[model samples]
Target: MTKTKTLRIDHVKHPMGLLSVHVFWCVAFIVIPLLFILYYMMIDGNGSLTLDNIKYLGSKEILRCFGRSLIYAAASTAVCLLLGYPLALIISRMPTRRQTTMNMLIMIPMWVSFIIRTYTIKNIFNDNGIINQLLRSMHILEKEGDFVKFLGTPGLIIFGMVYNFLPYMVVPIVTSLTGIDNRLFEASADLGASPWKTLLHVTLPLSRAGIISGITMVFVPAVSTFYISSTLSGGTVTLIGDKIETAFLNESNFSRGSALSFVLMILIIISMLIMNKFGDRNVEGVAV
Candidate 1:
């Protein structure tokens, strides 16, 4: 009998030098900036700490902007969920080659600059632009320049939000769906469950993590988006982000802007907590 020798190597540990570099970057970029913002929020023009900036959140105009932000964010998130979930499911069911092709198609718009995409959409809805010109040419409009008013509408803002953020929702859900074991579906069918029932009972439960992730991704940006509203609404509509931007940039009121930013951060954190709790309950319910 011949004895065979086996070679073994010890696992390589992460370098302390690399870890130190990451820590240095985090402290310099994230921690210091956040601390500076907090300091500014708590201080007045006289350099004295005060609570007045935080209390300004209750003023009527600020409250209205905050409420509008919440509404727009919620509406956009709901629409993305409705539209993205089905699209993700379809994509998940495609063959490997087709799935790659479809994913590329879905993500192609994201490769373009976001500002450019918004500009393109804005142009399409312009009075002399494609939609209106087509409407006029087709006699949908009574005469020249009798175009549909789409540029400054609430519906248009919501449409822009959905268009910009739909990819965020779709990619995560598709990832979760694709990660599911094929045998689970077969087992459900073998147990006499219908397709719809299997989806409701199994697929949805499994996809909860992705849904929560998508909601976070969509809601945060939607609530804080100023550029989209500014460009698409032509300055008629104002979100909380717009209010913050105006405070900092237009009025040079850093304290108020910082306070508003802090409030927005708190709101986002609360929303994330609620979503996580809801997801946990759903997972528990499904397990039961």
Candidate 2:
């Protein structure tokens, strides 16, 4: 019994043993849960195999939901890229202490509960909220019923996405910018490249990985976010997430929910592959 216990301890300490443990947990948690999704995707309420769930996604209303999700996701990502790239560049060039402080400031918003933050925004932009109150105080509006209509608009929904997800975009790009060798900039200057030219050639290409990473991080959540749309737009904006949510929650249609989830996974996977292809292309031979 002593010898057997000693042998068991040694096996547990082995590298392959650790790997085996990891595999066991992954199969139990990740793989098994995914199997459930697949099972539902292929079966109806009565547990009979059916393709109807898959076909439902191809319907016009569902297609419109998907299109809206893609558009909102793309728009939010573009806005984040435009805003975050410059902000990241600025942060990367700051003194290390300042960089840390600035990064914390950027991250502080995320520490707040997202639902609470959304409600805070809701309060600020509601019909009798701060903006309208201030505007009315200044006598900028004559009509009592006239509010700026900030809530329940496409723009506000996109703004909420950008606000919530901006830190994810900024941090990755900052890491990438800071990783780039400073000598590349010197060489570009020595070769008589202007500041803008150096930035376009030397800086952007090197930072492609972070840009793609940020895009993926933000876009993935933005596309599937039901809360932001539901809260900010009051369910007026129906993205694919709203559709999937409605299927499962309101309709109790597990098969339809799983099918929508499966297609969304495929769509996101295909997009990531394309982005990674561009990000991984060697920039070694670009003229210095």
Query: For residues 1-288, could you state the per-residue lDDT of candidate 1 as single tens digits?
Result: 111211122224534444555677899999999988899999998999998898898899899999999999999999999999999999999998998898889899988988999999999998788999999889999887588989989899999999999999999998889999999999999999999999999898999999999999999999999999988998999999999999999999999999999999999999999999999999898788
TM-score per candidate: 0.91, 0.93
Q: Candidate 1: minimum summed lDDT over ten consecutive residues — where?
A: 1-10
Top lDDT model: 1
The digit string of per-residue lDDT tens for model 2 on 1-288 reads 244444466674665654665677889999998889989999999999999998998899899889989999999999999999999999999988999999999999999999999999988988899999989888898877777888889999999999999999999999999999999999999999999999898898888878999999999999999999888997788888888899999999999999999989988999999888766664544533
Best by TM-score: 2
All candidates' lDDT scores? 0.90, 0.89
Where does the lowest 10-residue lDDT sum fall in candidate 2?
Answer: 1-10
Clashes of each: 0, 0
Off by over 4 Å in 1: 1-17
Q: What lDDT is obtained when candidate 1 is compared to the true structure?
A: 0.90
